[model samples]
Target: MSSAPVIGVAVLLVKGETVLLGRRRSSVGHNTYALPGGHLEFGESFEECAVREVKEETGLDIKDIEFVTVTNDVFTEAAKPLHLVAVFMRAHLADPDQLPQNMEPEKCYGWDWYNWKNLPQPLFRPLETMLKNGFSPFSTELN
Candidate 1:
């Protein structure tokens, strides 16, 4: 019998017209740009997972974490099939003055702020799913 898919939480840290992203250097999405996130630990709430992952991967604290959407992410691993339930979320820096740094050099290149309209190419599968679905959490048109 196949096991259930694992849960991964992605947090989009918003700052004005930009959001934080990192270039993945590890397996699953190597060389692709993606939001800071990781597998959800057992008993961890989505918001808590978001906060923890953001800090773990970016050396940044994020607040205002909110659920946005979910994606059924399917990919390959070691020539085997893999599946994951990706939970998307939006958040803001808990300390606005704190800048993001590359906390895990093994997993990511570094963190950088990019405008929503001009995001870095080759997004992770879950993030690309959000884009193809027309989901925009950080719209600049907040009037």
Candidate 2:
């Protein structure tokens, strides 16, 4: 049996005490908060895809990135079994003040900075864990 392959990239973008998050538009649980990222296109490396996705979804340029964790999850969406390979990375913005003007209006409803200590409930689970644990992807424990 052949399974459909999907590549997802997520960024843990931090600026001092806050982290950047975007609301997913078409997820099973709509209005869920997640890090800025998306799938990798053909001929693109994961790192390049990560940088591009952050810019496309959040209008921010990233640098000095470090690989975090990788996960594989199988779930059903829209009545279809979906298999995903998710890659998480840590990145820093050159200038947080600069916003990109070309974000998709529907896909990205809005952006916000949340204190690492206090995050809203029902955040994208993995992202929340990353924030609460202080950005160490290599560590196994959630500290």
Candidate 3:
């Protein structure tokens, strides 16, 4: 609906060989698996946004947040045509033994850790695009 593309911060919260994700309950990507993130707030740095979003959505704190990559996604087939510039970031769990909880039930079904080699079905657009382009959060080299 908006004329300009919205900026989204997607955190690849890693733990060993797995990453945290949640099934979206929102209209934009309903039923799709996605990372813990949201729109980048005005004047907020990428790291701050990633940290805040993860805690707000998953009730898990993250650390070592670093920029990974970006994806320019345009969902023309969606019910409402949409464009998004997704900024991907990599991070690790602040507490290694801490489990993730569904902090925002209204927006996400729940959070879980899935192996990077085998992800859940029906991934969110930006995530899918990133995978298609071979962007791996576990790797140090940027793609």
Best by lDDT: 3
Which residues of candidate 3, in runs, are more than 4 Å off?
Answer: none
- Residue pairs with backbone overlap in model 2: none
- Could you estimate the TM-score for every candidate? 0.91, 0.78, 0.96
Model with the higher TM-score, candidate 1 or 2: 1
Best by TM-score: 3
Tens-place lDDT digits, model 3, residues 2-76: 699999999999888999889999878899999999999999999999999998998888899999999999888
Q: Give the lowest summed-lDDT range of ten residues in model 1.
A: 134-143
Off by over 4 Å in 2: 100-102, 125-143
Q: Evaluate residue 122 in candidate 2 and report its C-alpha lDDT on the 0 to 100 scale.
A: 71
The segments of candidate 1 whose C-alpha lies over 4 angstroms from its true place after superposition are 139-143
Candidate 3 at 74: error in angstroms?
1.2
- Residue 9 lDDT (model 2): 85
List per-prediction Cα lDDT, in the order shown. Answer: 0.87, 0.71, 0.92
